[model samples]
Target chain A: MTMRSPLSRVRGLGSAHSGTEHFLTQRMTAIANVPLVLFFVYLLVTLAGRSHAAVSATLSNSTTAIFLLAAILSVVIHMRIGMQIIIEDYVHHDGLKMSLMMANTFFSIAIGLCAGFAILKLNFGL
Target chain B: MAEIRTRNPRPLSPHLQVYRLTMTMAMSILHRITGAALYFGTILFVWWLFAAATSRGFEALNSFFDTWFGQLMLFGYSWALIHHMLGGIRHLVWDTGRGLGPAEREFSAWATMVGSISLTVMVWILGLTLRG
Candidate 1:
């Protein structure tokens, strides 16, 4: 006889033991963001009020493009996971929670891709 | 949950509403709020990047950003970002198990608040000076 209830068995409630992934990823991205984001801030502040050509020239640099892409990717991942945790905490309706989580994931990916594409465009002058 | 046919209205656990705000609790909530704000702020950042890449919308975007309303929004976004970053640093410190004491936690919260404000102001000052 199984100790699990019928619903538990049906729902496949066994622990995958990978629960630490979310917590760890959040922290990893957080650590990465500290430096990347600071660099991002510095870039923006230095580039403030500059002409479009100047901004373009700065971004076209290989090293600058690389760091910008890394910042966007890391920041978006961190943003997505953080919003999911917020949704889980405050949203009580299961259906709404699932939908919001899906939207959260999609939104993060969309913005990240947009930012990445732009950076590449500048990098290649395309 | 599967076996219970009748649901009982049992006592619910006390939530945030029941607790008074302390520096620690306030900081935690502020961290979440700032983080949430940053999520939207990032959208604007993406748009800025897109404008820069295309090289078409930069002038219009710059004009808009020079407006008072835009400056206000930018200020708020910068503060939220700075505060959230400081909060993350505090969490990193606490993760090492060295800042769990009552005094340490509270002090860290206060430090994050002050440091974020100071940094944000300094950044804006630097930005304005550079522009000039």
Candidate 2:
């Protein structure tokens, strides 16, 4: 039992000063993924053995495009956060860990943008 | 800071060799492995998307994915996705301050393993039948 200011105790801030945000966000994405992934699996099953035009037409549907975009965004964010935690745990070197964390963020963003753009282009028949 | 040079080096506690493996421990490690697998496996998704959007390379990509090796990779990727998904659900249950008991934890671990395989098989079967 150490003495601490009431405000500080009430804040309950961790070293990063943002308590529980990362944990909650991760869970939020997981919850979102449940239905999204189910839909994705169903989509895949429907697309199997179909012609390129047929598959493209299915994905070009507005609803399909929207769901794909949301899933891609959620997945990329979730992946980045998950990888960041792993890197932080395993990488003891400060410099290398920082660099890896940055790379992870950029990689996730790149994947998200590329996938999202592809979906939008298909949806618009571009 | 200088003390680092003179510090004693010791084997860390809870080393894998010394500890008897348990279902929960194995599942925990598998969850991480599968998560990493999915991380790399996502490139396939991007490739498919790019191919679909361009409408030029899709036929070649599709044929490649139909090969024996491609089917094997797809099978592995599907299993990884489902397993990781069930593992995520288990984690979410734990986050709610529930399922921490020994029996519940073990059951969840087994359920994740079994459910993923079952789902993957069922999905593949459906895909195969519908293709006919």
* N/CA/C clash count, model 2: 0
- For model 1, residues A1-126, the per-residue Cα lDDT tens digits are 899888777563443555489789999999999889888877877776678988889889999999988988899989998998899778877788889999999999999999999999888776
User: RMSD of each candidate?
Assistant: 2.9, 4.0
Query: Candidate 1's C-alpha lDDT?
Result: 0.86
Candidate 2 per-residue lDDT over residues B26-112, each given as its tens digit: 899999999988887778888898888998789988888789887788878878888999999999889889999999999998998
TM-score of each: 0.89, 0.89
Best by the DockQ measure: 1
Q: Tens digit of lDDT per residue, candidate 2, span A1-126?
A: 869876776553434555388888999999999898888887876775578989999999999999999999889988988998899778877789889999998889999999998998998766
TM-score of chain A of each: 0.86, 0.85
C-alpha local distance difference test of each model: 0.86, 0.85
Interface RMSD of 1: 3.1
Cα lDDT of model 1 by residue, B14-74, tens digit: 9999999898999999999999999988889988899999877899988887789877877
Worst 10 residues of 2 chain B by lDDT: B1-10
